[model samples]
Target: MNKFLAASVSPALYATKANARIFTLSSTEHNIEVGNWKIDSTQLGIIDSFFSIEQKILHGGKQEGSKIIILTSPNGLTITLSPTRGMSIMNVTGQDIRFGWDSPVKEVVNPTFINLESRNGAGWLEGFNEMMVRCGFEWAGHPGIENGEMRTLHGKAGNTPASKVEIEISEIAPYEIKIRGLIKESTFKKADLQTVAEICYIPDTYSFTIHDRLTNHSDYPRDYQIMYHSNFSKPLLEKDAQFVAPIKEISPFNDYAHKGLQDWATYLEPTKDFDEMVFNIVPFAKNDGSTLAALHNKDGSKGVTIEFNIQELPYLTLWKNTDTEKQGYVTGIEPGTNYAYATSIEREQGRIRQIESEQTVHFKIKYSALMNKEAVDKAKKAVADIQGAQKTTFVHTPIAKE
Candidate 1:
């Protein structure tokens, strides 16, 4: 095969007469050498790709599309992304760099809402793993959930209530990897946008229709979700830990806690610190080296970056687990369309045009290692030109909630 999950091997999870339990166990891993970087994808659903972009740890493909791994160079520059989802810089710290203006978001809609990615759900690299965590970053998250009551990030098939997943390596790539799994449909009464039942779930699962991707293309598509779910070391977000997006400001939405309006100036470039779920829409980077969103360490110190191309996905979400009792120690920064099967407000407002069913949105996702904030700005602008405004308005204000 051109590529496949490395060390691919499966074990059962049904506690049988001898086992007498619920979940069995299985695993797979891969070691890839791409140029100067080495990548590893395990059956546990974890992917880690590393390279020397500069001094920083420029990485990509965290388990949950969260904090990406670093790929640094000598000049203290690097690039990272969940290109499969939406390429975004998970971290960058060093000399002033340039990536460019924010790219416009993209969306096209598909006929099937559940386009099964894989059975094992691509292991930990799978966004909906039992425990959502970084794909190729410094940390991975709560591997095997406890008591099956644990709330997983994306809540993959195996991680759900009574389901279990198993991954099968299919291919390996210089820029990406591929895998498959058996996903049993699940339901929960409290789950939003999710189906639920008493003691049964869907049984119509097909391993034949499964796939996954990871890339670093500058002009990638924007239909699928290109996100990053991360749980930085517990030390990262202590009241002072920071987070920033290279954009104007997050649009006011019902799902998040807001600090101001959509046009508020709270989105300062070179932000000293961040500690909330930030959603960015405006293009912040300029050719002259200017930005709108950025995260710094507490005390206005230095830290990592979390930026994405607006063209591919103008929308962004920065979720923080502030209340430990409520959640875990992770921050989800998803760079994609809001909610499921929705793009921006423009589509809802009839500004652009709504997508029809079965409309396949094709595009690319990219990641690089660059520590300069300026470089990031320049790169962002380059992407915007191609992704212009396909639609406008998020919900067309005043629409009665269904």
Candidate 2:
């Protein structure tokens, strides 16, 4: 028998608006396995008689005034999606563990316009520090002018609010809850991009899945780029936290990163004037054709694992920002269509991907927050296999082709 299963602790009780019973399982080390549902509001209209899964709309604070759609499962998985802000995953919690990070700003709302001045500018940095932010359609890095037009930091996708947002709760196998959302991103005379995001959760299970499909509804050939800027903070990213991944090669993105190549996996405490380090990773594919990476807490008691379809997102970027105690201390586990480099440079390197006129493409990423020792060991072993199979080498230069 699995040690985690054998050591099943008592079940905790949680209340919901409908007064439902949710049994949450945990271990001796305060490692919660499942979560209970507790929410009651009139904003959540009933779609069906299936009360096991709840879907509701939460109006943000009066300051931001953003509207959010929240989906809660019988288990302890909760997902918050902001339709007004391009349907980004604002916050995700599994058994009370924060799977994403929080910005210095209290209210998370989309900016009016994209700031295309510098890398860590004011406006872009506001939305850039969320849970899972989509980074591109045209560019995915520092602000620069390409083709004599100003390009914003990351891209405009994060600021482009979704027009039409839909939600549905259904069933899938043993999982009674399947939430599907469709968000539309289009410009008047420029481009149109549509995303159908799905989240599936099973009762008593500690993991969930996210699947996204982005379609191009334009007539002319369009250049597209997307990066899942998955940020993590706090308990999951302790001072001595470790990052593990099945990396085939590591390319430094800056001088600071090149200098810290020897100790890239280990995180440090937040300092006053610490420099940021960035690395472009070429992940090794497994027999299942998927690649994975994880961030484990100091004691290895808990961690967050990210799995992506290597066929679609062939590259990954690791952003280590232990810069300041106030505005820093978060890491990014990003999987994207291309490396997070300047659009001009990536295009010159033939890394920019183009879609045919009126064509579509799909991308998927899965986030799992594990609590048991067994799960952590398995993750470590998977990363170890990749390290053992290949010799990991680092490039000590700026982020570009020599």
Give the 10-residue window scoring lowest on summed lDDT in candidate 1. 200-209
Please give the clash total of every predicted structure, in order.
Answer: 103, 1
Write candidate 2's Cα lDDT for 92-160 as tens digits.
776647777656755655455335354533257765557888888656766666888766678776676
* Ten contiguous residues minimizing lDDT sum, candidate 2: 17-26
Model 2 / residue 340 / CA error / Å: 1.7
* Cα RMSDs, all models: 16.3, 10.8
Which residue pairs does candidate 2 place in steric collision?
Answer: 35-76
TM-score, per-candidate, Cα-based: 0.36, 0.80
Runs of candidate 1 exceeding 4 Å displacement: 1-226, 259-294, 300-302, 325-329, 339-402
Count of clashing pairs, candidate 2: 1
Stretches of candidate 2 exceeding 4 Å from the true structure: 1-63, 113-122, 171-173, 176-181, 386-388
347-366: candidate 1 lDDT, tens digit per residue: 34332321223232321222
